[model samples]
Target chain A: MSVRKTAFLALFTTFSLAVFAIEHAIPPLVPIPGIKLGLANVVTLILLRHFRARDAIFVLISRILLSSFLFGQALSLLYSLAGGLLSLCVMAAVMGLLQKKALFLTGAMGGLTHNLGQLAMALAITRTIGVLAYLPFLILSGILTGLFTGLCAGFAGKVLAPFLSDIS
Target chain B: MKKNTAWRKPAVIITAFLLLLSTASLLCLLARREKSDYAAEIFQDGVLIKSVYLNDISQTGTFIIQGENGCVNEIEIRPGSIAIISADCPDKLCVRQGFISDSKLPITCLPNRLVIRLRPVSDSSETTAVPDAVTY
Candidate 1:
């Protein structure tokens, strides 16, 4: 990768890590296990739009690993890894198939898959299928939060596009 | 780049479908209430450790469950509601989940491999109630 691209990714990684840490520090909005704003996803969506899937994946993995090391536990690390990877795959596919006009929908899809992935991990570890009842609640919250984050990314992309083109 | 409205149509349809599905599931969850004759079963490592009849219980009590790797969860049982009051798990998700009175949702401590589920009592003449589902 070019030095400029590497440096840009490093900057994005830092921004993502900061967002993750801040979100974690804030008290949960609800008592649900897998509900969160997922603000860092805005960065991922932006990266996927402006760059390549490979670059977005690198930044995402880095942010997950670094944030987990700094502020989360081993078990949470596993959950985040599973959720992040699944969400990334879904978002990448949506991006490729639908293009940028449907970025918000991609975000909603990512959120849904992310919750499913985490629920699957929870079911595996606890060995309980009854936990599947939480699926609907998770999906509801995922759609709302994902839409919010997706809109934020869309706005951020609009504001940064001109400056980014100048830099490149 | 050309501004296109084609993607909006599909996005709207998908979002509407998801909304409908979520609403239906929410209604089902809210409508399905277990009868008071249910029993709360505690499982550790997928093994039945304890079962308490919700109707029979007259007193509220808290008990500690020790699981693999020194994991501990303090479960609180009332006349009808059951909940995890405290736990050594990192996320404390089980604790944050509060209490449950129905069979629809099971409170689980994933890291500790502990599960608490409410199941309806069978009316058969058989004295022992066979588990409807095996967790593990």
Candidate 2:
């Protein structure tokens, strides 16, 4: 890869890591676990749009791995990886299958898939079907939060278009 | 695939559909919350460890719940609500959940593989709700 490409990836990864740390500091909106705004996903969405899925995955994994050391527990890494990889795949597929300017919808899809992935992991680890009770609530939160991040990505992309041209 | 194809049209329709579906299901699940005559059921790795009728408890106390590979959680039992007061798991999400008095949502400690939820007394427990018919 060229120097510019490598630099762009590094910059995006840093941006995502910063967002993850910031989001981590804020207490959960609800006392229940596994619910959050997922603000870092805005960086992933931006990268997915401006760059390739490969670049977005790089940043996503880096952010997850790095943030665990800073604020997350060791076991939480499994949940983050599961949710992150699944959401990335779904978001990329949505972006590919649909036309442009559907950022919000793509984000909502990503959010739904992210929660489903985590739920699956929880079920396997806990070995209880009762955890499935979180499905509807997770889906609702995922959609809402995903939409918010997607819109943030849209505006950020608009603002960065001039600067991103050279890197793209 | 290259054309814009009025993408907003389908996106809006699908968003609306998902919003409605999730909202309806959430309402359905939440309707079971805060019922009278509830029982607290604790489970570890899909196995029922203990259960107590909420109406019977006269005061608050704690139960030490154990999980696979030496995991532990201190669950506080109150008159009608259950809470995880402390835990040794990596993420203390269960402890932060405070208390739950109904079946609306279970307090689950994923790290420890423990779950605490409330059920109405009239409803049968997992042990007694066995299937009677068998064919081989």
Candidate 3:
């Protein structure tokens, strides 16, 4: 990759990490475990629009690792990593097949996938299947949150379209 | 991107999750409602050290259970509903997980091998906050 690409990826990853860290600091709007605005996802969605899928993957991996280190939660890194990868895969697959207008749908699906992945990891580590009880609540929250993040991504893409095209 | 009336994705996911929750609720309803035993066995080096039950818990704030390794495990029972409030472990996640009240689930700190399981009660009044299974 070119230096510019590397720099862009690094910048995007840092931006995502910042978003993730800040969101964690804020008290959860809902008492549910997986509910969150996931504002950081906007960067990934924007990248998917203007860049390649590989670029978005780079950003996602970097964000998960660096964010985990910053939080000093290395043990929990496995859960986050699995969840992030699954989410990115689902979002990218949906966005690639569906039209740009389905951004909200893609985001919601991504959020649900992410929570499922995390919950799976939790159950595996704890050696128990009891966590499946919260799936309904998590999915409901995911739909709401996914829609919000997707809208944010769409709005950002609209605002940047002209400049993005001009620069390219 | 073009948009269509493809609301099927979210609908399916939501339905699946709701079904799972209902199944859990059903299981909880079927299981006989009994009092919480609150009995916990503190084991170290594959040997049992002490077994403490809720009723016997004194008004004292904290008690230390000596493990075989001479590692004093400090257990703090907060008067009302006795739960393990803290432990010296890398991931304090289990500590923050609060209490367990069902036989199917146990709050475990992997690093410390400390397990806090809900012992089944023989009485008829106590209700478990969660079903005997783990909720996703």
Candidate 4:
């Protein structure tokens, strides 16, 4: 990659991390542990389309890991890892298969997958299927959050379209 | 041609998740009907602060009791009789969790450094729900 591309990637990655860190600083809108506005994923969806999936994956993992450390919650790292990996898989699959016009749908799926994966992991670690009781609430939030972030990403994609039009 | 098919993924996943959640809820309700004596310990900083039975609280009633430390924890015993009610915690996430009786969910108060947990009937070998392990 050229220096300009590398510089852009670094700056983008840092910007993404800043969004993640800042969102974490805000108290959760709901007292539920897993729900959040997921403001940072808007950046990820944008990166996924503009940059390579590998780079987007890198940014996602790096941000989650670093954010977990900063929060001083090592136990949380497991949930984050599970949620991030699942989200990346689904998002990349959908984004790769669908056209640019459908990017918002893919982003929505990513959000849903992220929440589902986290809830599944929480259930496993806690050794109780009772945690599954929260699945509906999480899924409902996932849909709403997904739509909001997807729209945000949709606009971000539009803004970056000119520069990224030729990447593929 | 394939336009609407894309929507199928989330639709399927969400439906499946909802079904599973309902199943879990039903199972919890069934389990609650069983007659079992449960001992829950509310521990604060390794000290046993409170102990209560699972069957002690009815479906609709306040489990609120002041501990010796003079802290009030509002426990709600409902269908899912989860014990951690209201706490002095800044987060108050535990308070909003509602009643959880399913033995799977534990009530946690971050501010008070307290955790209310349910142990299975067999594990309730101790005569008192509160263990002798911690200093009051």
- Report, for every candidate in turn, its global Cα lDDT versus the true structure: 0.81, 0.80, 0.67, 0.69
Per-model TM-score of chain B: 0.65, 0.64, 0.50, 0.49
Off by over 4 Å in 2: B1-3, B6-13, B34-36, B39-136
Worst 10 residues of 3 chain B by lDDT: B127-136
Point out the higher-scoring one by DockQ: 1 or 4: 1
Q: For candidate 3, what TM-score does chain B get against the true chain B?
A: 0.50
TM-score leaderboard ranking: 2, 1, 4, 3
Candidate 2 docking classification: incorrect
Interface RMSD of each: 6.9, 10.9, 7.5, 9.3
For each candidate, C-alpha RMSD in Å? 8.3, 9.4, 8.5, 8.2
Docking class of 3: incorrect
- lDDT of model 3 at position A37: 77
Per-model TM values vs. the true structure: 0.67, 0.69, 0.59, 0.61
Question: In terms of TM-score, which candidate is stronger, 2 or 4?
Answer: 2
User: DockQ of candidate 4?
Assistant: 0.09
Q: How much is the lDDT of residue A153 in candidate 3?
A: 87
Q: Write the per-residue lDDT of candidate 2 for residues B29-109, one digit (tens) a residue.
A: 788565567788888887888888888999999878777778889988889888999999887999898988766578899
Worst 10 residues of 1 chain A by lDDT: A159-168
lDDT per residue (tens digit) for residues A24-103 in model 4: 77865654568887878887888887787887877777777777777736467788888878988888777766644456
Q: Candidate 1 — which residues are off by over 4 angstroms? A: A166-168, B1-6, B33-136
Clashing pairs in 1: none
